[model samples]
Target: MDALEILFTASFWVAAIRIASPLIFATMGELICERAGVLNLGIEGIMTAGAFAGWFTVYAGGDLWTGVLVAALAGAMFGLLHATLTVPLGLSQHVVGIGVTLLATSLTYFIYRLALPEVTSPPKIEPFQPLPIPGLSKVPVLGEALFSQTPLTYLAFLTVAVVAWVLYRTPVGLAVRAAGENPSAVEAQGISVTAIRMGAVMVGSALMAVGGAFLTMSAFNSFFFEMINGRGWICIALVVFGSWRPGKALIGAILFAAFDAYQVRLQQMSGGIVPYQVFLMMPYALSILALILVARRATYPKALMIPYQKGER
Candidate 1:
């Protein structure tokens, strides 16, 4: 078929949804922490840790649910590490985040190499199947694109609404916002900024890890050192692009995923007619442009990346 047709087909939208799910999950998690004034750069490490942990668990004869549970737990541990360094110790968020990423990524590789057999050929497990909603699956193109997805995909989108509600409606949500906007005021309310920040980091890290687990379990059923492939960085850019809102972040993720989906398809269909490198670079390039455009006007938590001390302001 033609390029336009290929881009607009039902299959394309399905691919877009599939490709974007992980980012949506990560972005949602980041939105939570960012709204609370903590900038987590350790997302890369968290995701990598999740991916390997999930893959390793499933590969070792555990069920998929258990594998995902282990992934989230692993991610939370990493998140706890980040919180310990940033929240209580008051370290540089960027420095500690990058360090976590380095440690987690290298640690995953080391663990995988030591634990698994036949390291050269990555092993696989039966990945989660798409559970198409009964009647909804029969609808037009939109049906399959939206409803016919793995359970995780549904959860990722559902999380957007859940996050929105939690951020804008609930009492703790108010505290989270307060923590970001005015920790001084939060302290005035007798709330502990350090505690809230810790919770946010732990939750965000778990979600980010699920995103990474999505790579190993859903996107492709195997472990690869390069599977994360900077998706975490793209997510950081997306956070700016989304302006720290769940809805905007979801939209930005889908947009980027659409470009990514199209890029992969175009490469296959064009068959050397187009430079493959250009297609490969599309998502990252768009992310850079998106960040540049959004960074100027995007609103952030007032105390973001600023270490909060109890008595000092």
Candidate 2:
């Protein structure tokens, strides 16, 4: 193939990685939390909160890194709320998640309106550029495809590796898995299931926040209403689709992202032959399909969607 043809094809794969980065992070976060026996349906809300927090930080003269920090903080706060409701109070996880989603959406819209009065021409920030590795960028097509990616993409891969290590090779990971499976037994052993669960939830929330921050600071560089859309929810579905395993969830997240990436390409190729609305529904459609697959497989967390009572533990 010609050099330009090679570049074009390589760029397509790179674009898919860029598009999938946020999903990968969020999915991995959800996987960890779920593995701890906590179902964080509020991932969507946490992500939305992060998106606005990150965007406003940038709008207010902060750098991209600062925005990301704020986003992680926002996510942690939301996670705290979720943890309080479902952990100590013993409220239904489903209710808490739905409440978080509603609250986050309303809060984001309210702040966005109050902060940006002029909708006609909103200000935008510059996004992160791809940072190539020192030596990896020169190895032909695969090199550019793998190394020529934004910092967040590199972070995503690093996150997966770290999480995999922690999940499979660490002492704390054992506690987390045990907490999810048999809380009372874990508590009897004095390991503090509640503490482990709380820690997991907060960590997961921070990761989800970064995922949202990436959408604004690195992926799009601008925030619109409901900027996260339903990406967070997709991550939640991915937990089940991936059977609550971090590695599997990462794969599922990437697969979903690939479907989305290809859907866009298909729409462009159709040249309006297929309605744009139809193309827009692809992610949701695939999400539903994933849910169906999950139902058929029945591989969700054994204790997912259940509130954990302190005494019960």
Judging by TM-score against the true structure, name the best candidate: 1
Clash count per candidate: 0, 0
Q: Write the per-residue lDDT of candidate 2 for residues 136-241, one digit (tens) a residue.
A: 9777666876798888889998999899889779988877887787777777787877788888888888889889888888888788776787898888888788
| TM-scores, all models, native as reference | 0.97, 0.92
lDDT tens digits by residue: candidate 1, 46-75: 899999998889999999889889999998
Q: Stretches of candidate 1 above 4 Å error?
A: none
Q: Model-by-model lDDT, in order?
A: 0.90, 0.81
On a 0 to 1 TM-score scale, where does candidate 1 land against the true structure? 0.97
- TM-score result, candidate 2: 0.92
Q: Give the clash count for model 2.
A: 0
lDDT of 1 at 175: 95
Clashing pairs in 2: none
